[model samples]
Target: MVINFGAGPAKLPREVLLEVQKELVEYGSSGMSVMEMSHRGTTYVKLHEETLELARELLKVPDNYKILLMQGGGTGLFAAVAMNLIGRTGSADYLVTGSWSAKAAKEAAKFGKVNQVVPKPAKYTCVPDPKSWKLDPKASYLYYCDNETIEGVEFNFVPETNGVPLVVDMSSNIMSRPVDIKKFGVIFACAQKNIGPSGITLVIVREDLIGHQLPTTPTILDFSIVAKDNSINNTPPTFIIAVVGRVFAWIKRQGGLQKLYQDSLTKSNMIYAVVDGSKSFYYCPLEANVRSRMNVPFRIGGPSGNETLEKEFLKGAEQLGMQQLKGHRSVGGIRASLYNAVTIEEAESLRKYMLEFLAKNS
Candidate 1:
């Protein structure tokens, strides 16, 4: 059995896939695949409503929050957040923890002023201390990425935004753990990581923040317009949303977010233990506290890393039916993305491989 560890478009639960296979061609006697069904038709509409309701139920999203299904990945919502809320005070505060947040701040700059709460660091390793952040109380919103997939860094705690609405890009970490739905004004995630596929983006925003888009904001990017139509303003990604619904159902069956969070802790710890115990053989760059539970990035052959051994590592993993252990190109190393669907057995197998590689190479 092949265990996939790629970051996005990562492994989905096997049972969910099997369920999809069983219903792919004819969803509940519709006589057409979900892909072939019209998004606005009765069948797909019911599916869509159920998906949204499932999401709200699982996330414990408050009545005040509206969960919107939209296109344009996480990057698209970067602009959407600025377009929708930056007009409130004509500026936004951003906590630049890693590549994704840095990109978000840059994008928000086009629509309004961007106040980087802290200067961008030379290397993306850990989150800067919140005490050191210079936040603006008058800013429309404070933005940050909950987990940086590429750097393997995560915010262990939410930053106190000093009453400024907190806007977060949780693309890589959403649904992996429980979150306080009321802590922020907006929480957006792309479906590719932990939720479903690549075509849909989920935005959870406070109903109060729905309107008030910038005058120049496109109708599609306008959160108010999308929310007004129940995310059916234009053609929605029917198949992707359907798959996301299945995944949400799978989460509920697996005991919801708390269970997934516990599983995440166990799976990541299994691999992290191997890396930490390897002496100089393996090294993870981030601090112990801020290291990501979803994605673990480590270098082999000391902290500077040995590219030769890294290549050998990937080859041996592939031979054992494990793949995508390679890190991001910008940061060369081995990365095991312990997403919700990557089973404990898969993580333990990776841990075993790491130890075996260490023994043979050392």
Candidate 2:
């Protein structure tokens, strides 16, 4: 059993992949492969609608929200959301907790004014105290990332938007836990980490937020056009969408989001315990309250230890058939992404490896 722990383009459950492999040749009596089928064809269209319907029911997304399948990843939505929503007020409020949110705020600024709400030090170690946030009453929406894949930090609490729409980039954390859809105006995720492969994106937007986009916004980026077209404005990533649909079904069979969340907590706990017990041998920078349950990045030989040791750890892990333990390029260390597909057994195995490595290096 090969284990993959890369962040995004991460692992899908073996069952899902195996079934997909079978259907890849010929998708369920349709004779032609999904690749050969037209996007407008009945077989592909049914899969498209099924994907949206499953997403709605599993996520418990409300009837008022219009589920849109976007083409670009979460980064695309960074600009798409800004152009579509910032038209009303000409500005938006951004809570810069980590890299993605900061990037979102920077991208949004290209369209209009961006009001930043952050604390001193501008660190990604933990969530800024919401009480200290300087929310702009006239802003178009309040935007934040639910989880930071690079820094391994996650927001423990939702923001109180007052009267503004709460726009979220849930790329790394969506579907990993239970979330109330009624609180937000827009919630989007790139289908890579937790959902499926890259190429397809999911955007759940409130019906009222559909139209009224900036005149300068591109036709495809315009949520109004994309929504009306039912996300098939172009060919759409039919193959990837088919894979994502199966993943959604896999999550449902695993007892839905609640069980997935518990599995997440359990898996992360295994690795966290190893980090905490290693006495100074291993280190996780984020505070306990905000540590990510999905992406857990920890140093190989504590804070003061030589960074050179990380390479040795990676080599050892690779020798043992483990892969993609390296952290983000910006934050160099190790990050084990425990997405829904990564099992608790793999996490426990990693923890065991951590202890063994610590003992040898120490």
Candidate 3:
């Protein structure tokens, strides 16, 4: 009855959760829980291999790309990427469109110099023009966040970096839609938001970018070491990985990336239409072209309002079993995270509730 809208550690598919529950006590007749299995044991090893293969197949990842199931969350990658790639070059280009990307840039600066290419004031509502980005030829990689969870801004089109390797933090919108794996050199995401639970991280890196870690990079943080060892340099988050494997199986059975893309579009469109049709009762401040399908941020008042509207919205939603509609603290507005697990029906129900609330409160 609960609708979870927290960005990370968000809601999971019911089937996946059920499967995890069933296997919690006995995993494939191993007579032990998945968490109790030794990472180096054959059973765990097989599970690990199969999960990686499934992820690659689901994403249509090319053979040249190595999928590493590593530890550390999306934030860890922000530093790992800089340490591994921004070594001798001592510089990288970053596109700052939202909170996550800005954080990535800040982390990168700790390793070396970062050239921030922010969106123009006029085009803040849209993706920055790739041609306008001041790319340093000596830079190692260009980093960006595919979707900003807090700001509700997304990049509808891929940015062309003129041959510079593209590194993206897809934590908030990883498997919500289809993506061309060949378009980027490395794509990393924390599994909690869309794939599975909070402990495991997914990293898809082009083979060429695996090595070249700086001397200061920790052994566990080095992508080359992790990729070379097949992400077994140390114990992994076995339970989370197993759960993610089940989620991947569910995604494949539900119709793969194309179906997910269509579902996301339909669900997002349904809610957005309601907001747009609400006239001045609701306000979506994000630029139209860059609106995110995974996270929708909206305000109840036209231009200005206090916390009254938000408080009422949460109270009314909770009363109707529609939970977690509060916005992020950094951005004081309503945010509904419609990840892969969220059905169109739930979104519609929320839309209906919003309309009713407006009618009563407006």
How far residue 106's Cα lies from its native spot in candidate 2, in Å, is 0.8
The window of 10 residues in a row where model 3 has the poorest summed lDDT is 118-127
Q: For each candidate, what TM-score against the reference?
A: 0.99, 0.98, 0.97
The model with the greatest TM-score is 1
Instruction: List candidate 3 segments past 4 Å from native.
Output: 119-125
- Model 2 stretches with alpha carbons more than 4 Å out: 119-122
Better by lDDT, candidate 3 or 1: 1
Q: Judging by TM-score, tell me the better candidate of 1 and 3.
A: 1
lDDT of 2: 0.90
Question: By lDDT, is 2 or 3 better?
Answer: 2
- Each candidate's number of clashing pairs is 0, 0, 0
Give the lDDT ranking, best first: 1, 2, 3
- Winner on TM-score between 2 and 3 is 2
How many residue pairs in model 2 have overlapping backbones? 0
RMSD of 1: 0.8
lDDT (C-alpha, whole model) for all candidates: 0.92, 0.90, 0.86
After superposing candidate 1, which stretches have Cα over 4 Å from the reference? none
* C-alpha-based local distance difference test score of model 1: 0.92
